[model samples]
Target chain A: MWTWQHVLTTVFGSIIFPLIIGLAWGKLVEDNKSFGGVLAGFFIVGTVWLLNHGIGLMYEPQMGGNLPGPWSDMALAAFWGLFVADLLEGKKIELEPILSGILGGVLGGLLLFAMV
Target chain B: MNFRRILMGMCTGAFAGFGVFTIWPSSLARWNWLGGWLAAGIIITTGWLVNHYAGGLPNKEGGAWVDMALSIWLSALLGGTVVLDPVNGLIRGAYGIFHGANLGGAFLTIILQLIGATIAGYFLYAARRSDA
Candidate 1:
């Protein structure tokens, strides 16, 4: 019985974190077409999200929530689209970098709230 | 100078902090000052560690987009784990920020992180280029 919290954490850890990683960290280090960076970003985000949920258990015994599978899917899809756009454009988009992340994080938070 | 890398470390630490407070507001009150400092220290260390180890490699085979993507990805995972709750808590407590307080502020955080990464990357790229 994966609760909503579990789902939110997973989405944050897996999808959101990865997307951010792909965009931010990947931009800094990788130079090989950005795919590895993106993949690594995905992995890192997923791990962080999971770590947060795991940490939650220490404070509360019964964390509750349903995993928003569709939300997670949408998040992933959006990130990939962004990644592809970056790839085709031949550069990382000149976005207000921190602002973009903040927007993404907020959206993620809202999604979590809704799911919960 | 190495200062840029250190700066990046700080920036990443800050973002890590923001992420925690924003995502899990419930945990904010439990942590004290010491707890928060410990957490921030951990994230800074993690950023340094990642930069120290797997950071030298660049997206040489690809375009600028590739390089930036890799850097962001590395930071996100490294930042998320190393920063953890203690660090995140410390950050929020020190800064007096909260989740949903600056609800749509991730973009700002990301910009800071990017600035840090760019500085670090510039030096790293320069060093690597010199080496080759």
Candidate 2:
């Protein structure tokens, strides 16, 4: 709950985890097609939505994932974090970055689901 | 005149908020996370202890302390499930704003809604005053 572990994990998982995933997402489309970041973001959102509702896909600590607390915030932050990161880094907002972020966010969600 | 715009903005915001909420799930509110399950468990335990020690006498509410205890856990289940409340719609939309960098204008949408909602609230209050 409000334990130190929960608070620390919240920062780690919610902010740091998403930032890392978002950074990678930025690179996902830098080299390839420069299209559909919005669409990709939608998919990432969709995957997380599925994970949240899907019976067996939970990231429960008592279960396999051992996530300190509910990690859906991290899942959500993953898709949206890229844009925030780019803005802070002063990176120009272009079609490609958005496209990669969302597309990569989808990948991140799926990857986490598989691992959990 | 201006009222029309206010209504429009409110409608648009509600639409957008609900849209975000449609995707937002209560996974983050996991019953066990952040002591939610613990709260329920403690209440249930307290109920049991009361029943065992104090004879679980019925109260004015027509239910025993133990019966009330049973409700603590049963009702506690709502803490997490309650994410569906309309206010959570705003919460979900706030999360969606994280994508504003890529999509742009996310703030404007929320701002318009804020103004619209304020004006609407005023009218609601006004309606209660017959003299107005």
Candidate 3:
């Protein structure tokens, strides 16, 4: 049952989050060059979002069928992007990786709680 | 701040992301444990290889490409995690995008995730600093 609600959720989760995160991440990590990172990150995640939607429209599978949960997908994408930024800096910080996920999870959980 | 440190940060982030993806609700039941572990290993290895071979490259975009590679590998890992079949996996994926489509839900999710990353990144960065 794909309703308006579903569409709205999709638009944000798929499109908006990546855009905001890309911008924020770029700004926070890359400073001057975050503009490039933001653009690149947005394009990369946007492509995935489009692909996911396009596939869904083309093949309307069952609910909870093939999708990996949102948490996993976004986390992975962000991790990859951040990884590139970190690598460029040339300083390997061991504890910094999970910090983002944990913080993201807490923030996500709180938001979900508020919504629910 | 240097290339080595940044590479280390990327690797750490990738590993954490892999763990989050693999050892979660799905890990308990529907997901393939062995496959997930194997995939994580491969992603980590690829990160290491990239660092070793491309560490000193003058081009800045190389790092971005590495991030892109991580996304592809993650998509592959996620796609592979579809134990019930591709259609089901995709439908579930749709459900995610569907949720993300909304302003309230999407904004909340993004902000929270980023905040989480920031706090976590700071701590991790600090720990690494102390280690040095």
Candidate 4:
């Protein structure tokens, strides 16, 4: 059964796990702010999870059923972490990045679904 | 926000997405981690080509490329999740599978996709600005 405990676990895990991993990668690897991106990624996922939980509570009981599963959560969190780290280092958004990202995402999604 | 560029981008993205799925089905099935990374490279390259050709965007050397790759990768990852919903629905509907609606999940997914893409865009912008 889905409960508050489950929600709490999902949120906290999303944040803390990435935080620890990012920190470890930074400390042992290169000592960069890449960890911030990692944190951001999980933070986004946690926020989304929390939002889904709230919506579920307010509306239908199974409203959260369509939320991203664990694999997506981890993949997105990791990528976000890298992106945040780049931002902290003063990276700029350009037309190429924006266009490329959208393009990449569409293809990546198709590949993922095909695999599944 | 040029409509022509957006249309071109959509076509490029759709083609790349479908192409990767077709080419690497075996690798994707054998090892997810390696396969995912390989697909990331393909998608990023495709996105870069689209930007360069369709949007007239220029590329820089060094860490800038990494930043571009990362942005594209994450954006694509988020995009994949967003696209999957409609695709899944279509597939299910084709088979006459019925399920209750999860409005909360749908809303959250849209919100998350937007946030995720925005974050990626911000990073890309920052990276490019620094390069300039």
TM-score of chain B of 3: 0.38
Minimum summed lDDT over a 10-residue window in model 4 chain B is located at B90-99
The digit string of per-residue lDDT tens for model 2 on B9-115 reads: 33322222222222233323443232322322232233323322232312212211112211211111111112333344412212111222221222222222223
How far residue B127's Cα lies from its native spot in candidate 1, in Å, is: 1.2
Please write out the lDDT profile of model 3 over residues A3-97, one tens digit for every residue.
Answer: 65544444334333333444454443355343443343334433343443323311122333343233334433345435533544464544332
In model 2, what lDDT does residue B9 have?
31
The predicted structure with the larger DockQ, 2 or 3, is: 3
For model 4, the DockQ equals: 0.12
Q: lDDT: which is higher, 3 or 4?
A: 4
TM-score of each: 0.24, 0.27, 0.32, 0.36
Model 4 alpha-carbon drift over 4 Å, by segment: A26-71, A112-116, B1-132
CAPRI docking class of candidate 4: incorrect
A8-57: candidate 1 lDDT, tens digit per residue: 44333333332444345544445544344343433443334334333431
Worst-scoring 10-residue span by lDDT in model 2 chain B: B72-81
Task: Put down candidate 3 lDDT per residue, B44-101, tens digits, no spaces.
Answer: 3343334223331111432322232333233323222222232344112122332332
